[model samples]
Target: MFEKILPFTRKKHVAGLKCAFTGHRPQNLPFRFDETDERCLRLKAELRKLIVQMIEQKNVTHFISGMALGIDTYAAEIVLDLKSQFPFITLECAIPCETQAAKWSERYRNRYFGIVEQCDKETILQRHYSSDCMQKRNRYMVEHADLILAVWDGKPSGTGMTVTYARSLRKSVWTLDPNTFSVTVE
Candidate 1:
């Protein structure tokens, strides 16, 4: 007996503006592990607002998230949430490694997987984690994006490094201050 095979259909690519996200993990955020905190709620609101602006005003059709534990997770979720209203928008998760969430708590791991499941695409940089795997992921996103949205506190960290790298490439970087709820472009 012959077995019938179905053709693989790839997701359509919409060529347009793209944005990448970079931010501190939960350990660096003011409301670490407290999603219910007022600061966290407000930060999410602001992130959602900027995403809407990107979709509506800037016509950005694609968003890349590194899938880190804090801001990356939040940004990816925001993009997925906006997909209902802006159906054309797509989210791509740039995972540093296959086991990126292996050591996380069950709750966080579940959330990460949930977001990954809903993202339109995922790019795994490497099969295993290395010292520079995170930087590699960050560079990949920055190289592929037209703009970088960073939630930073003006301190030196991975997020700061990503911002610096993006700036070095002359890419537009919009930085959001987590403490002040203000945005600055570089």
Candidate 2:
């Protein structure tokens, strides 16, 4: 149902090295929307470390986030925070639909908008949501990116599916398990 994609940022030459994010939502995370929890804080720390590693070592200049809750939100924020240090890096919000956060709580909605406003690029994949819109957005990110960064619990969920899809395309996939704080590359 995606007829057109819209970008809200001024045009710039796309970067050569890019990374895309796929992850579970808040409900599936151990902290369950409680960012103050020690577990959540630790997870964010690890996530930030991984992103920095990607930027510093791999020369990844572009990061794409699905703009979902939980890990996606964390990734976008981490990218923004690192911008002062790595001014060449850019964050792209690969939103699945125009109203992706319409049903979210007011707190989350505000957070989403704040991140979107600060992002270097905002890509709305579709004007309206569809049954497969999320998957469509995931594929869009994987297709555009050179590497896929995933936060998955090894379950048959959306994040798992995105990892599988990335592998099938022979894209480099790095997975970080939020539960054990372990990372695997494939």
Please give, for residues 1-186, the per-residue lDDT of candidate 2 as tens digits: 333233445445445589999999989988898999998999899899999999888899999999999899999999999987877788889989998999998999999999988887788898898999999999999998999999998988999999999999999999999899899988
Clashing pairs in 2: none
Q: What's model 2's TM-score?
A: 0.92
Error at 82, model 2, angstroms:
0.4
Candidate 1 residue pairs in clash (backbone atoms < 3 Å): none
What TM-scores do the predictions have? 0.92, 0.92
lDDT of each: 0.89, 0.89
lDDT of 2: 0.89
Q: Which portions of model 2 show Cα errors greater than 4 Å?
A: 1-14
Name the weakest run of 10 consecutive residues (lDDT summed) in model 1: 1-10
Q: Which stretches of candidate 1 lie over 4 Å from their true place?
A: 1-14
